[model samples]
Target: MKKRFARFKSGWSLNRIFHDVTGALFAPLLISLPVWADAQPIQTLTIMEYRAHLNSDQPTVRGMIKFADLVSEGSNGRLAVTVSGATVPGSPEDQIKALQEGGPHAPDMMLLVTPALRHVEPEFEIMDLPFVVHSDRQAHELLDGPVGRELMSRLESHGLVGLAWWENGFRQITTSGKSFIHATDLTDRPVRVIPEPAFVETFKALGATVVSLPYPQLYQALKSGRAEAQDNFASQILVGHLYDVQSTMTVTNHSYSAIAVVANSAVWRRLSVRDRNVLQHAAIEAGRYERDLIREQAKTDSAELAHHGMTVHSLSPTELARMEAMTEPVRQQFFRSYDPKILDLYRHQIGTRWITR
Candidate 1:
């Protein structure tokens, strides 16, 4: 027996024995190993994407499309976005609801006007106050500042994430028969206002019979003589072909119409940190693009309207002051409903002098 054991040990060396034992123990593990173990770990990540829907095909919607393109490029195919205009039918409120609830057809992001947002958060009405924001510069300053940031942050409670403030330019008046040369011109006139309380109150304060209507219905309303006058951005007037039905354009600049780029809160949270940053920066850049487009369009819209047989008029500084004064009660009524701190912040940002009351 000793002679047999010695011969076996000499033939089976320690290294060979250890190797055979390890191979037997690890044979299943080696076979069961994932394919990734033999190759480089997956360098290609799954692409993340989202969809955006805007209320109209205005400059803001174009900007949203630009934003989608930017997010895709900025994220290097890690994130993608697709944008469509006026995909949802009905009022802006309906669009907002679709944004709040997510689905296959519902949008992950939306470009909502400030007035529509007022229905969700009344503090948004501060941005819709007439003549409060004097120029594009003032509007940008206010919306890009602390007051605007606070207002945006407040949207979290409403299941929205305010990304940036785009614009519809300043609201101007268009009438079918008469030109708005003074605040009194709107008095007793049937003027179509957006379906927002502030708009209803502002027009009523100016002594006009306010007809609350959705934007899509305005041109037909005027053409059918159901409504005689309306206020909207010059781009909206040009795009909607309101000049075809309306005979006059008044550069009232009554309120700077701001469009908010908002994402659903749940959707926002689902994004990776890097992707959220990309989306946010893309939104801000696209908003700047939209504002520039609107402003440039404003410079020539009057001439275009004139070419279309619509006489365009501008309100004199004195007349604007008078109009603002006339709307003071409307402002006061809205002010009482706002958070004092937020109102004060807005007032402070716009300069106290601009606040008539």
Candidate 2:
């Protein structure tokens, strides 16, 4: 009986049995490791803009495309970027609504102007005040500097992440029949103004009958004689082929305009630290690219407009000063429309000597 028992014990070693049991328990986990070790699914982000594919030469669209490229490269294959320029129809306000709500309808990003935000937060009108900044450097510094940063910070509450500012250049007046070499040329003229109160008021202050119209309808308004003149940048004039219809270009620079690259704040916050860094760095780099490109393009467009037989007029220092003085009363309206605190900041930044109560 002892010999039989010894044979049975030798047949079943405890360590061998334990090894078999442990291996069986962990077999499923070990076999499933390849699934865990595989790369994660890629995430995609879309950028919607009013202009891009319309005229790929335009810096606003080109810079945004470059931004998309930088982000894709920076994120490796883990992230993908889709730039849909000129995708959304209607006014920029329409796309802006999608941004504020965020979802399938809202794109992950887009380029916008101050007025779009002004409608959401009236403090933005501070920047819209005519002749708020004198030089290109001043505009860049104001929009990229402390004031810009503060304005951008406020966007967080509005479900937007204001990344950086791109240039739309200065807003100049274009006339269909007369050249605007002097401020009086604008007086009583039927000039088309954007659908903003400041624009309406500025033209009204110039003694012109304001022809309020959406951007899309401006060229037709000029052709049909509903409007005789409009104020905007060179790119826009070229965008609408207005030189073909408009006879003169006045470099009044009555107001400044910008294109800000903003993202859906909720989506922005969900990005990983590395991803956020990549996106932010890309945005800043792209903004600089657009700003520099527009500087050269503005010069080229003016020359091209002259080639097209449209007279390009520059404002003399004296003329500009007179215009600024003429518009001073309208600038003061900021006190009644926006926060007095922001008005003080804008006045300080723009070096406007007039004090607002």
lDDT for each residue of candidate 2 in 1-357, tens digit (9 for 90 to 100) = 001111112442221111111111111110001112127766677775544224445676568667766776687746666655334445657767777777775578877788877867777766677877678998888888777887888888888898888878788989988778777778888999998988998888888889999876788899888889999888888767788779999887778887778889889889998988888888999899988888989889999989888999797888888888888888777656666666667667766575566
Q: Write the per-residue lDDT of candidate 1 for residues 1-357, one digit (tens) a residue.
A: 001111123443221111111111111100111224224331111111111212323455457556766775687645555433224455667767877886666667777778778768888888898877888998899899988898899889988899898887788988987788887888898889987888899999888998888766787888888888998877777767888889999888988888888888888887779878998999999989999988988998899889999998898989988999998888878777788888778877766664433
lDDT of 1 at 88: 46
**What's the distance in Å from true for residue 57, model 1?**
8.2
Q: For each candidate, what is the lDDT?
A: 0.72, 0.73
Give the TM-score (vs. native) of candidate 1: 0.81
TM-score of each: 0.81, 0.85
The best candidate in terms of lDDT:
2
The clash count for each model shown is 0, 0
How many angstroms is residue 20 displaced in model 1 relative to the true structure, after the best TM-score fit?
Answer: 71
